[model samples]
Target: MTTERREPDRNADERTMLEGWLDYHRCTLARKCEGLTDEQVRTASVEPSVLSLMGLVRHMAEVERAWFRRVLVDDDAGWIYCSEADPDGEFRLTDADTWQEAQATWQAEIDIARRNAAGFALGDLSRGRSGSGGEPFSLRWIYTHMIEEYARHNGHADLIRERLDGATGD
Candidate 1:
């Protein structure tokens, strides 16, 4: 992949720090899919689990769209994949899903997420549901959550990638 993952600076402001870390995790996920074919990426490493590198990409795209477009932006932008009919569609990758298209959509959602967050301050309240009282969530909270989400999925990607070709690293 062309994108290079960078480390977050310690001396940066909170917003920059959060964004940097989030970006780092995002790149980590992308790195796991680098140099892999569509069929290889579609292979599930663990039995009884639909986990795969491409599935993770698709899932992250849905996450970005949900949090940034529908929640953060307070727009009624519909879901990306998961729905009543196919609740786990994001993780259900087949030979039909080319790596290029999945990667493009994921990257695009990340860009949109950045744009949505740019228009708000860290403390800015999102219309999305909060932890309690049905209150709005903060941009900072959303950023932190997104970072955690990527970190967890990146771990899964690591296992799947290693099993796929014996390749491993951050």
Candidate 2:
């Protein structure tokens, strides 16, 4: 697993600090999936949920792509890892039948998200992007929302992975 050092930018403001925190949490979530076997990765302690470590990786990948690449960047791009046929199908097990496949998908999505995030300025919150809402939302709100979503899920992942194996943090 790779860890990036956090550096404070003299020019950065509060939003940049918050974004850095968000990025750290996201990276941590991805790291949780590292150094595990295929069977261990797919093992689910909770029945009916199928919320395996690999599943979380796939789900979070979809999230990064959906939020950063699709919603925040381009609205016209087709949804990644999402479909109307099965709304929550990204979590469903499919041909990611192997551990390698799951890891590849997760890494690919994370790479794309990091690349997209690198392009945006911390203060670039002027555009109002509206979802299934009555009004639009600022970029600040979107960044915060993504951070919250990842942090919440990472907590769940921590427990799930611990249950699956004795593995813990990076």
Candidate 3:
């Protein structure tokens, strides 16, 4: 099978530093979903879990939109995957429709996330509206949270991808 390759990094800075870390986990997760057929992407290797690679892609799409667009940007376009009727539905199997559709959604989310992040300054870290009205958090906290979330999922993706195929590491 053909493996997709990533380019080498050139230089480093505050922006690149954050992006490098983000890209590391992002590409790792993307690699986990690579080299699989559409059927494989949709297949639930873990029975009764609905946790397919396609599903993860879709879920992360919603996650990026919700966190960066809705929450951080104050767009108020509403949560992508969560609502009163379907709370925690982000992980649920909805309608990724097809492999291409899922990938497009994921790409869109990533693009928007990159754009949103670019608008911020490196040292700028402040909170906006609180969902619970309990307390406030810094933008730095949000960035760190996003990184942590991706890192955790990348680990899971590594194991899942390994089970799906013998592929490992970049």
Q: What TM-score would each prediction reach against the true structure?
A: 0.94, 0.78, 0.80
Better of 2 and 3 by lDDT: 3
lDDT of 3 at 160: 67
Which should have the higher lDDT, number 1 or number 3?
Answer: 1
**Best candidate according to lDDT:** 1
Model 3 accuracy (lDDT, Cα): 0.70
- Candidate 1 vs 2: which has more lDDT: 1
Candidate 1 lDDT, 37-76, residue by residue in tens:
8888898878999888989999999999988877787877
TM-score-based ranking, best first? 1, 3, 2
Give the alpha carbon lDDT tens digit for every residue of 49-130 in model 3: 7677777777778777777777667666566556899765655654546778777877888888788777877555433455
Q: Which residue pairs show backbone clashes in model 3?
A: none
lDDT of the candidates, in the order given: 0.88, 0.70, 0.70
Best by TM-score: 1
Please identify which of the two predictions, 2 or 3, would achieve the higher TM-score against the true structure. 3
Candidate 3: worst 10 consecutive residues by lDDT? 1-10
